[model samples]
Target: MYLPGPVYDVVSVDIGGQVLAPEQYRVDAAGRLVRVGGGCWPDCQDMAAASGEPDTFTVVYRVGLPVDQAAVAAVSELTCHLLKGCGGSGSCGCKANRNIVRYSRQGVDLEMPDPQIIYSQGRTGLSLVDLWLMTVNPHRLDSPSRVYSPDFRYPRVQQWP
Candidate 1:
């Protein structure tokens, strides 16, 4: 079975008829990696057929949130902007001014950006971040889709009934 998402750690792996050692593979934030063109076959194989033999290419790994550096940078930039606009230590008393009529506070007129427009337009006021997300995560799906079969039945604990 091909495991998806960012694999952080790999517990074990079996390929061909031999079990791979810890030194054979390395797990990183991005994914798991093994020696190229290593194992039973001449070339590295991602998947293998099921066999009654000892060699069953199987892998055990822990999948985690696939957050990349670009995403982190994007979130950080948005957070910084909010903190700068509104005081982080305490409220600056500058509420959102969404009204069309200009409002003045301390001789400075300000108008709050329309939240409805931003939401409807799917914009975060950050062009670069929006572009990155649009390219990297357009649908915003957290994980890959898994196929489910309704015909598959699970074992029942009640045998007498």
Candidate 2:
């Protein structure tokens, strides 16, 4: 299958763990990693860079087909895959890989999507807002004395009159 973004290879459970797969490698002429040949369509270096920052991350939505329920289910499925992603769910702010991995069917009810982004602001390198946005537990990696999310911001929508 085609994994849409760059394979940042969430390899181990931590930022500094041994890797277990082929990831972004450079090509002499290419200068950047050759991701096109790999299954990853969009290069992931940019996203990874953002994730490793102090207070930045992104949430993206892509709809392959607009109306099919199955297509919608793909969102949940994709989200599940993301949650199950290799880096051991440390910062992607998602449920344990089990819940997402075992899910075979998809529906809005089963979908509690989380962010694909990460930041280094809070105690665990992420804020509660980040976790909440990604449907992940803010205390997943807590050490019993962690404080609130550092980047917890409540942005309201502006209604134009």
Candidate 3:
């Protein structure tokens, strides 16, 4: 079975309340869980029981791309930007000039980009943070895209009494 995300590691796999040994299955590079030794996953499981109960299949895994040097740099930049003037004097530097869309002093003029516009475009005001965001998610999707079909068997959920 293929997992939805880029799985980093599989911690455990449980079926019918029994934790399967690592030798029983292996996760492929593409995040597909393949059964080993000719064993097969159950075609159907009882959903009424809580996960890990009898007739349940559960997979514990970590998802996401592995953090690299570029990711570390991006996060550090964002953290520094957010922590600006956090431990300073009575005046918080970060708070000053936050809402000044336009400013003029001594024949000098400056215009600040509106924060709402940046937020609406799924970007942070910080350049490094926004660059990293754009590199990773150019489309600015809130979640991964999924295809739905009427024939698909979605898990049952008790929605109403």
Best by lDDT: 3
Residue-wise C-alpha lDDT for candidate 2, range 1-161, written one tens digit per residue = 23244433322211222221333322222122233245433223243454434333232223232234544454565565566655675554443553352344555335433323223433222333344534433455554464688688644322110
lDDT of 3 by residue, 11-90 (tens): 89999989988778777655678887999988889878888898899989888777877678889987786676575642
Per-residue CA lDDT of model 1 for 53-109, tens digit only, reads: 344566767666557788888888777767866874434323544455457889899
Kindly report which residue pairs in candidate 3 clash with one another. none
Kindly give the stretch of ten consecutive residues in candidate 3 with the minimal lDDT sum. Answer: 152-161
Residue runs of model 2 more than 4 Å from their true location after superposition: 1-65, 86-161
Best first by TM-score, ranked: 3, 1, 2
Whole-model Cα lDDT of every candidate shown, in order: 0.59, 0.36, 0.78
TM-score of each: 0.40, 0.15, 0.53
> What residue pairs are clashing in model 2?
6-44, 10-87, 114-134, 115-134
Ranked candidates, highest lDDT first:
3, 1, 2
Measured on C-alpha atoms, candidate 2 has an lDDT of 0.36
List runs of model 1 lying over 4 Å from the truth.
4-11, 14-19, 22-59, 64-68, 77-101, 126-128, 134-161
